[model samples]
Target: MSSFARHRPAQPSLASVGPNKLTQQSLAKRLLFHSHPTDELPPIFLSETLPPELTAEVYDFIALALRAYINPWWTKITRYDKEFLPQVTHILVIVIRALELRIQRLNIPALVFHDIPTILSQHYADYRNALSKLSTSYASGGAASLPQLFSQMQPHTAILPDGKIDPEYFRQVFDYILRVCLPLEDHEAEAERIIVREVIVKVLLDDVLPKVTQPWFVQKTILDLLGPPAEGEYMGPLSAPPSSFSFHNLLIIILSVLQSFSGACIALIHAYKQAIITIKLVQHSPPYKSSTLPPQTGHTGPPPASPVADQSHTFVSPSSISTTTSTSSSTSSHPLQQWGSISAEPLTITQVGGNYAAPGLAMVSEVFSTRDRFSSNIFHIMLTMLSISITSFLDKLLPYLLLNTLCPAFILNITRLSKRTLFPNGYPGPQPQEPTLEEKAEIRARLVAWRGEGVLSYFLPLILGPRPSETLGAAVDPLSSAQCNTHLLVLLLDRVLMGLFPELADGLGNPSNS
Candidate 1:
């Protein structure tokens, strides 16, 4: 037996087996009833198991579908051999169903109610026709039709077969149309205009008008949104009828309130002045006084005796004695006593007749001086308080009024203007008259004249300015000359492009078309 085994081919070991033998032995039981390799695996196997070549083909189909329907006009109707239409339709339907479910969950009413159904119904016939063509082409040496594959795709008995179209279904359809068809449509320009108009109207009605009525708040919010207004630009409301509330009206109201407060301040100042004047007049009035003196005895005896004895002498020299007696009597009489009393009493310089003496005037002057000083200080204090109060009131009130009233009104006005500009015929309206030829011509003429008078004089000077020379002897250096030429060329190009296509020109000259 050992000699026979050596002579015969050494029994083949399991280690020497090829892959074909291993496969046959290992898979033989699994492949018993199956003719193809794929028939043995689960139907819902992961795409990761797919061969690389098959994955690449699937990717190509997806890319082609995406690009082809991007513009509906670009669909390859002329090529009957292409079998991609049904596959694209299948993908679109799946996308639409997914979108419908999403919109239904979100509860977006506009898309559900207004837009979706219209889009789906309109595109449905075209989709069906494309699918039919793809299937017919596919049956004659092409890929299997989408419908056929779908029918074979593990019967979807679990899903309900109800045909009732949901509003959400339409929304999904519109979403798909926007994603796929809108880019491909030839009516993009018109569609864009319509969209812009709609957005403007919606914003005016919903956002802008409410803001206008509260001008102060609106302005602040707008500043926040758009940044500070440019210098010399309309930072406030536009002119309109007084009956129509605006930002300016709120400003006027604030000013009126300030004026009233100022009037109150003026009244207060007047009251203070009157009080000072009264106090001064009372201070200058003189005080009253009373006085007494002892009674005086008459100088009788000696005077009489001298008079009798010297009568004869007096008769002899009557003229001299008469004069002497008269002098003595006058000196000795109550006139002296009255003079003494008058001297003893205090002498007050009172205002006699209508005129005041210097002393009397002094009292008036001193009182008035005090009064003036007090009045001045009081007036200053009052003025300062008035200013502070007014400022404080305004600081508080202005913002409150602006936020609560002015901003909303201004926003409303702007909203109205926007509506007029966007949807002139949405409400009852007469068409606005076009500008007269004379007016148009006058405007044009004025513009042209203004431009001709040197709107660009500064620029011309810079361009024509003298260039730096490399050496005093050298004519312009080649480098400098070249730079000058380049500058001129760039300037010329800028002007030409701006004149021809102002919209296309940015800081850079027109961007390269390529």
Candidate 2:
């Protein structure tokens, strides 16, 4: 027999003891040998059946162990003790498979969602700390231990039975990694891209899109979350109202546009700064040398006539006259003489030729033309109107959006309304008796008072607040606050159309169902 088999205790024959006693002892031995020991073994064997709760607890424990310990090692440990690794891996796989089957049979949605998130969060925390330590150690020229590497990867193994990660958990991890570790080259580029893409896509489909299904609710929630659109007392210009469509589709479009705009703006600012630096460098360059001008010819008028008649010009020898004239001309034309003749110090020309003018003109013209084109586009006009209206709505609704700040009166009114809509008679759970008409009236009065206060504080801001400053001047000429207000109005109209008559929006805009 193998050494392992030899070490394992032998089973006693049924004849040696009553069957019940024999079975009890066998179970006790098995329980003792299990990775985790439980106190419920006696009930499990004495009754000849395992309690449902006990089975569930055992499976949960095993699942936790597999998720926390076993799976992490799969991607790590290039070399491990073969015998030990195989044995541990086999045991873990069996436990995991068995738990998966049990979970499937149970089909408990709430338990699955709740427990899975808790497990994932715990694993994520562990992995996060482990990854940090590993990175620090590696940076210090120390090699990562196998266990450390395994720990760093453990969170990734919390996959569903179908081998997919939990959608919500995946999104949480993806966003966390992007925010925290993405700047580190080693973490960001490795397996992160695939992981992020998968999680984001899944979350959009599962979590975010579902919320968009109810248009009015979505609009209200979005207004609550992001604050309302920036309109004043008057809503701006509007086109056809939005058709009836899924709220999720509209939110997706809105979010996409916001993200795109933000990214574009950042890129533009970076480019602008770089262009400015380049222009400065060019302008500061030293001036080029001018080529030498050709020397000027000297004029010698005919020699002055001699005073004596043909005793002519025994005045001076011709050679002497010629030599004296040449010397005088050379001295007058010398650089030192030219320098002495100048009265004003030479002006330094700081500007470079072929530099600023052409490029500056071109840039200005291009920017203006682009702005004009964008301003003329109907889509841009619409988007601006939408943004403004949304902002204005948020401004007016801010007070009501606060859960804690809402008046007790408003809460009572909401409770009454909820009772009328949902419960009819009263709430499901045992609670206080039905309210009297007088009490209800008092609640209503309080709600009205709170509502008035909310409207005053919130809506007043929209009317009285200063306009947003223009980000770009005439060069870019993006939509102004007023224009954006107008666009927001149009967007609301679009929302209305989509919300009330989705078939039309679907036909017009071709928005995705998701």
The digit string of per-residue lDDT tens for model 2 on 260-351 reads 99998998999999877755544553323211111111111111132111121111223212222211111111010112111122211111
Best candidate according to TM-score: 2
Off by over 4 Å in 2: 1-193, 209-214, 222-451, 454-514
Model 1 regions more than 4 Å off: 1-389, 407-417, 427-514
Worst 10 residues of 2 by lDDT: 329-338
The TM-score of predicted model 1 comes to 0.14
Per-candidate Cα lDDT values, in order, are: 0.30, 0.32
Candidate no. 2 TM-score = 0.16
